[model samples]
Target: LGVRNLIQGLGEALPFADDTFDRVTMGYALRHVADLHALFAEYRRVLKPGGEVLLLEITRPERALPRALLKFYMKGVVPAVTRLFRHSSEAQELMRYYWDTIEQCVPPSTILAAMAEAGLHQAQRRIVLGIFSEYCGAEAGTDR
Candidate 1:
């Protein structure tokens, strides 16, 4: 884990010049963004041609049973287990927030469209258990 230049910046208004990085990744924060389109566009602007953007998010399942099961696991089991490992209730609150965001987040199609509109091509979403999702996109005009 010898990573250099670990920097933090606002998603909506990235403090970087054009084509600065080869790749960008957003994890579990897309739901918190006010404008998905704008955030995607910003990601594109900072990425070099052929660069990739990866987004990791929790998504709502299509089926009712999976949804109910996920809710039970996240809201009930996860928090309860977290309470055992950590003394603070903040972990439980964080889990609740994650579940709420996943429950209320926009559809995966919308996110893909935003990536495409932001000049990213080959955008695709891989969903696991109808819950965890990995959204990946490459910059347009790239042979990658």
Candidate 2:
């Protein structure tokens, strides 16, 4: 858990040398990226040949019932609960923003296509619980 070399930088323009990392990972931040193509290109640039990329995202459910339920939980229940315990408007607003992003995010097909367009091989998404999406791809080469 002690990640000493963590550097805060933009996903579209990574602050690292080419082929510097064997793997790249992001969690619950895909919806915040301004450009999926640029982000995936940067990821590919930094990864060693055959290196893998994994992104964890909360995708909005496709069906109306599940989407409504998720929206109720994230946008309503979470904020309400946060206000009850913490009395912080910021926390409540953050949850609302989270739901908004998920609601407005592009579909899984578009994301996968972006990855493939960025030259990542075998791009695919795995869904869990109809809401959690795990996007994965590998740099185009044999493992070094």
Candidate 3:
């Protein structure tokens, strides 16, 4: 866990040079990105050839039961836990904000398309428990 360089930078305009990294990961922040394509572009730009990209996000499930359960957890349980343990209104508000964004976010297909358009081939979405989405893709390697 020794990360030497962790720069605070925007996803749309990453501060690193081209091909600076071999792997790029965005966790639970896809819903907050204003432009998915631009963010993916920056990710691709900074990644070395054949570099991996992993996006862990809260996706809206298609079915009724799963969606309902997710909503209940996000809107009800998360805030309650935060309010009780953390005793922070701001943390509760942040969780509420996360739920709102996930509720309104674009579908997984659209996000996959954006990754493809950004030159990330082999884009795939692996959903867990019907709600958690793990999006994985990679840049074309020199062998390709």
The stretch of ten residues in a row with the least summed lDDT in candidate 2 is: 135-144
Q: What digit string (tens of lDDT, one per residue) describes model 1 on residues 28-143? A: 88888889888988998889988899999988898999899989998999999999999669988998887898888989999999999988889999987678899999987453
Which portions of model 1 show Cα errors greater than 4 Å?
2-6, 142-144
- 1 or 2, greater by TM-score: 2
Clashing residue pairs for model 1: none
Clashes in candidate 2: how many? 0
lDDT of 2 by residue, 8-74 (tens): 8899988899999999999998998999999998999999988999999999999999999999999
Please report the candidate that would top lDDT against the real structure. 2
Instruction: Please identify model 2 stretches exceeding 4 Å from their true place.
Output: 142-144
Candidate 2: global Cα-lDDT? 0.93
Q: Least lDDT summed over 10 consecutive residues: which range in candidate 3?
A: 135-144
